[model samples]
Target: MILAETLLFALALIDCGAILFLLIYYIITLSDLECDYLNAQECCEKLNYWLLPKYIAHSFITFLLLFHGQILLFMLNLPMFIWTTFEYFTVPRGNLGAYDPTEINNRGQLKKHLRDVMIYIGYYLIFFFIYLYSFILALLKGDPIRRGSDDDIVTEI
Candidate 1:
């Protein structure tokens, strides 16, 4: 149980780090697109590079929590995972898993995408906090490993 909790914490930590990176990247790219500093297709392509790995990491953590019997955590994360996964699969593909800039006018797509990214960042922040809480609880309650009794301790002399 401790092992599972520890692993879950570690994986969640890594995934959260990736989410932070994506948040930054999205903000910058979206700003650049707004200013006409970057081409829409090129910007989307760069963002697309990270999408698959993000999806994979999210799914792995969700499933790990489920299989480890962390029911509450699993339940909390399941809805978002399912919603994002469905969005990922259902979106039109020619744009490379990103919103097609031409589909919306007045920079609406960019603004909407940025808003969505922020929401996901917020969700991840809460999710990470929950994982951290569980990990700390496990550590506090876990028993220390004992290799041998006190009699087996070797004296410095």
Candidate 2:
């Protein structure tokens, strides 16, 4: 139980930190996106839908952990694992907020979009295991094990 909880907490914190970084990166990219083929509005909407929710969901899960909301934690994490599974396949198809495929007319553009999709998906995929481990720990724990423990939490300067 201790090891599992330790791993769960560590990974969850790491994932949340990485998510914050990603949110910043996505915001920078959205503003800096070349507006030749992709509409900036569309890119913003995609960020709102995809990247923003990731930040929210990850943060909410961390809150759930801090307060020891086991049931809610399990519930929220289950769907995310499932969603990540699907994203593993769909992301390669320009389905990950890259411009629509039909919009790309030439080979160079197609390659560039594919490379973009791969980079986004590749970096993001590392966190899927964190989510997976969390879901499993929450499921197995079945109740709050760390409900009263605040000793492990670290405060920044």
Candidate 3:
């Protein structure tokens, strides 16, 4: 069905946009942590190794779709990308000290720590769901998320 195909195509575009948005944000956030907080440049290398390729792939898919005249879907990504970029520039960085007795003793500091951790987790989840839902929608639309996923489709349903 054309509707299903459109949904599949849209999911792919959103997945691409989501990753691009989060990849930029995460890289900046982690880099800030490594540079200004941790002072350990090597700390985020593994994450970069794992994510850089995916980011590239997402970019490629989004751009290709855009070039092919998917204007609305591509346009939808602009606000997210802009917001993420804005957040990267505006968010503050702090020292990454571990296990300070004063921090635990102060309830306010504890709350702040909790809030920051929750926010970081939230950022991860936001894009994670985009990736997840894209795959799910793809499968539901009878499209393959990957090469091996094709065989799992049931047409009679």
Candidate 4:
């Protein structure tokens, strides 16, 4: 059980680390105030490539959590899941309509943004529930209770 707990903690740490890294990367991408239309497209493409490793890491962590039944491991996996879901929706993808802006005007852009927002929000909700379910299961198991205590039991007269 101790070994299992340690492994679960390690996996969770890795998972959280990956999420922090990805969050930093996203922040860096957004920090560039000069990011324009083309820049946004390029950033999105680059992000897509970068996300592959993160996806794999997340999947691996989830696998460990499920197989090991480590609540800590599942807890570690939750942030990455949430962040990725958020990223998927918020990351700007080019317009779905014709590449040319002339064909798709303000209304089209608004619609596209709305669609992306909805998709992201929906997915986030789904993943959130999944994480919550796993977390609750883990919590129910409770932490490994320590075996020994030094306290003395006294009888009152």
TM-score of every model versus the real structure: 0.79, 0.36, 0.33, 0.44
RMSD of each: 4.1, 12.7, 10.9, 8.9
Order the candidate numbers by lDDT, best to worst.
1, 2, 4, 3
Per-residue lDDT over 64-144 for candidate 3, one digit per residue giving the tens place of the 0 to 100 score: 546656567556555544543453344344422232332333466434534544564464455556545655765577544
Tell me how many residue pairs clash in candidate 4. 0
Q: In model 1, which regions exceed 4 Å deviation?
A: 1-3, 93-95, 104-107, 143-157
Candidate number that wins on lDDT, 2 or 3: 2
lDDT string, candidate 1, 1-157, tens digits: 5346676677777776777677688778878887889987777777777777778888888887778788888898898889778867887855546566555334477778778888887888777777677667766666555446867874542
CA lDDT scores, all candidates in order: 0.75, 0.53, 0.49, 0.51
Whole-model lDDT, model 1: 0.75
lDDT, candidate 2, 14-99, per-residue tens: 67556656656554554455534456455545543664456455555545554554556556555554554454335445443434
Clash pairs for candidate 1: none
Instruction: Find the 10 residues in a row with the least total lDDT in model 4.
Output: 96-105
Give the higher-lDDT candidate: 1 or 4: 1
Model 4 over residues 13-117: C-alpha lDDT tens digits? Answer: 555465556646544543431234345455545445656675566667676676776566467556756665565456445543222233223456434533543
